[model samples]
Target: MASTTEYSDRESLGVGSIVGESFSILFKNFIAVILLALAPMLLSSIIAGAMVGADVALGVADPDFSTSTSVTTWVLTIVLQIVFYALTTALLVQLAYDSKLGRPLQLGRYFSPALRAALPIAILTTISSILAGFASLALIIPGIWVYAVFSVVAPAVVIEGAGFGGLGRSAALTKGYRWPIFGALLLVGICAGIVNFLAGVFAGVLADVGSWAMIVGFSIIAALSAGLTGISIALIYARLREIKEGVTVDQIASVFD
Candidate 1:
């Protein structure tokens, strides 16, 4: 299933092209994209509820920062975050390929690959997060650099099934293309930030009218931002793979060849 397409040879589609293509795919399957984006939030809530229920049954009080309950919550949150992000990554990778091939999108195709890809994705994601954290602690530039460098980790994990090796693969693929990835990531961040800022402003206005609406709206905005960010990251991975692995639109077109 590897046909080299013309787009594959055009690695210089650069930042604008990448972002445009991502948004195009997103809009084409807006409903599916939104639902995929919402999946993590919904799953998290369900898991948290179950945890809380178990804690209550065991007579556990609300967790304070010093308590085991707090630790458990943090652990659960991290695990859930990894699983959700991995799943989103796999789904988006499949979607990207489908979009490129002019094939119909299918929601059912998302989960299995996600599950298969989870471990490597989780490891890469965790490492990237840690590196970013250390860089942030050192200086903002380093943190941002680390983030840009590892931007394609999810895509590597999903497409290559690189597992723990995904981070290294992403780094290698992105070696000469740092600025492009950085620009794309920055663009996504700026757009998401704007959406978030607008959401906060709207929430404040709604709060003045009704607190519940404000809370609900804020929650929805947060979930949408997460999903959109995840999808954008996945798109970046696809583009990088096409460039690094020499997998082009033509190759994609001649999958059976």
Candidate 2:
């Protein structure tokens, strides 16, 4: 019934409320958030580092990136990274809902659904990111707009079990609120970006040729950033459903049970 309602009949997206709730959720579950995201991120880095080798990632030596072999390796690394990113995002989406609902954080229960959704999420999200990347190459604003359009793919896929249709679902939900959504994401992203930058600088501590400190430190920062970003997206998705379809968070979280 609510889904049949027009956009004009719906409420505002409430960027501020979503942003506040995202920060609250992330702050309250800070350690758990980081840990939930750490494994996939750390593995991604290791896999990418192994594929590209120290010469490329650390610049310890000059390797011809123009070579076909090197190009294939880089592409493979990107694909793997996207898969891990999707997996991490999927995990965090479940955590966000459970945490928001004040439910016990059963991290294990989350994995079953997350793993089931990860492949489709990875595929659709790769398409979204590639589109965003191309738009970014043309201009920055278009890239942000494109990203905002599909910002909730992970949550939609995992929660609604929408699979490949997640992209369309996100696009539809975000249609009228892309700018506000982008604003909310950018505000939170700036905060996370600042921390990530500091961590990057701190990672330089006694580090050269991609030392363990650099690897582990950046991975930790990335894990934290991923956690915050994923939580924001989850909250945004829930808010969008509430605004446009009169759906409650409880209704959305019910799928996990």
Candidate 3:
């Protein structure tokens, strides 16, 4: 099941190549990818919207902003997001692996590996998020830097079962290739942002007519954006392994068995 497609060698990929390859994979497996990613993405969006609604409610109902409800909502949203992102990342990585190896793209078939590795993934994702947050708080550049280095962490968790050690694995994979990774991520982000912006614009136009329609519009956009991000990262993870470990797509995917 070795792929005929040649991924870029370690440290050899440019931003354009990464972006192109990601979109290619995404388009090729559009339905499977979207379906696999939909649940987690939509749940996360609902949780996010709840968090916002909670804050708004607190502001309106309790002007002092001294409510336990706000605190609880914040905590719940953060925890749920950590789980959602981790599971979705793991699922998407497996999907990308199967896609690369020309295996069946059954959305249901990918869930077992994701759930099997759920705890470790959640832990690693939470840590990565915290570290990135701190980096951003210290300085924006460092935060972005940390994010790029840890971009492969989900793949590491899925393929190597590196758990929390996936952080180190990701950093090693990206060692001298940080710039390309960052560039690739930035381009993807810009594209996702553009789609999101367009969606928001459409939502706003609907908002003047009905709030529920706007909510539905934004929810669809959020889910689509999340799915796109997951697929792109999965592709990146596969490419990183090919380049850094000199592994074929099938060899890396064998970890699932």
Task: Please provide TM-scores, in order, for all candidate models, with all chains considered together.
Answer: 0.74, 0.90, 0.80
**Whole-model lDDT per candidate:** 0.64, 0.82, 0.71
Whole-model lDDT, model 1: 0.64
If both were scored by lDDT, which would come out higher, candidate 2 or candidate 3?
Answer: 2
What is the C-alpha lDDT profile of model 3 across 1-257, one tens digit per residue?
11212233535755676677667777888777667766776666565665655223222223233688767776666767767866887888777777767788767778887887788778877788888888899887677777887887877877787877888988888777677677787788788888778767766767566644565565466555566677677777777777767778788878776
lDDT (tens digit, per residue) of candidate 2 on 1-257: 11223345446788898889888988899889888899998888777767776334433445557889987888787778877887887898889988888999988888899999878988998999899899999888789878999999999999998999999999998987787787898898898888777666656763664565576777787788888888889889989898778899989999988
Output the worst ten-in-a-row residue range by lDDT, candidate 3.
54-63
**Runs with alpha carbons beyond 4 Å of true place in candidate 2:** 1-10, 54-64, 206-210
Question: Order the candidates by lDDT, highest first — what do you get?
Answer: 2, 3, 1
Arrange candidates by TM-score, descending: 2, 3, 1
Q: Between 2 and 3, whose TM-score is larger?
A: 2
Best of the candidates, lDDT = 2
Model 3 stretches astray by more than 4 angstroms: 1-11, 50-69, 202-216
lDDT (10s digit) by residue, model 1, range 63-144: 3358887777766665665556556666666666676578777767666767777777776787787788788897876677
Instruction: Select the stronger candidate by TM-score from 1 and 3.
Output: 3
Candidate 2 contains a number of clashing pairs equal to 0
